[model samples]
Target: MYPKMLEVAKSEGNKEAERSFHHANEVEKIHAQLYQKLLDNPGASRETYAYYVCPVCGYTSEKEPPDSCPVCGTKGKMFKKMD
Candidate 1:
């Protein structure tokens, strides 16, 4: 629905709504990929893997977080780790 919302926002000339919907759509795509990876590796061990999440934008990473969030430009140091 974000894509559809994006289209609606575009048609209405709502710049802020368009930006929000576009960002949400892109982030959701990344989340879907991460969830698919988890499904594909059901037997994977947590001892060797972890998730790092950006506090600002909810960007999640299977490894170390990047120096900047791909979604919202949050700093890597602001990311919290989980296992």
Candidate 2:
């Protein structure tokens, strides 16, 4: 949705496009706040964990990785989402 909003801004440069971009950003901020709130809740912390997947070998992990994959030795950039 954010990319589509940016495309709208690029295709039609006007006040409306700028407004749409700000609105989209605002929505994203709200969503982040909601997620943070959920994570901050007492019982929810144990239920939630960071998730990642190696694109090269389809290995999934419960945390975001850096530099390399622990399972199949893939690079960090090759990681995708398992969520």
Candidate 3:
């Protein structure tokens, strides 16, 4: 778990590991929320919309990404479309 890794990294005073784990933890939270949303509404996946992910932060969106990533402020155009 990224959070657990982050905690260990913090305790060890490893700044690089802390940063990496922090980033992963943030993305993992977004993924979990997205997965929970889909689980809550099982039919939501029936749509033919495409998914987009922020290259910088791994933020995901359906149909279309926002003008800027809420987590990292990466532009929508920078997001990569999922196949």
Candidate 4:
């Protein structure tokens, strides 16, 4: 998406848009770094149970889920399954 935006900016001769697109790409790289850090050192663990807690919103789901939280976009590693 950033590359596409940059291409559009180039075609439209919009220097500001091009610069903003590059800035967004830089921000994404920083976010990726943060994610990598979390992956490297996931803090703790919880005993698996039937109920699952969403790390982002604290919403509990009765079913096992994938990486993304249904309510708040938290990854599966963030969930704490309750007994």
The sequence of per-residue lDDT tens digits that candidate 4 reaches over residues 1-83 is: 78987999999999988876775675466556645755776772232337576655555555575567654467977888877
- Candidate 1 has an lDDT of 0.83
* Steric overlap count per candidate: 0, 0, 0, 0
lDDT of 4 at 80: 88
TM-score of 1: 0.84
- What residue pairs are clashing in model 2? none
Reference-based TM-score, model 2: 0.36
lDDT of candidates 1 onward, in order: 0.83, 0.64, 0.86, 0.66
Candidate 3 per-residue C-alpha lDDT over 44-75 given as tens digits, one digit per residue, 9 for 90 to 100? 87766689999997989887989999878899
Clashes of 3: 0
Q: Estimate each model's TM-score.
A: 0.84, 0.36, 0.81, 0.50
Model 4: weakest 10-residue lDDT segment is: 44-53
Model 4 residue 65 CA deviation (Å) reads 36
lDDT value, residue 51 of candidate 4: 59
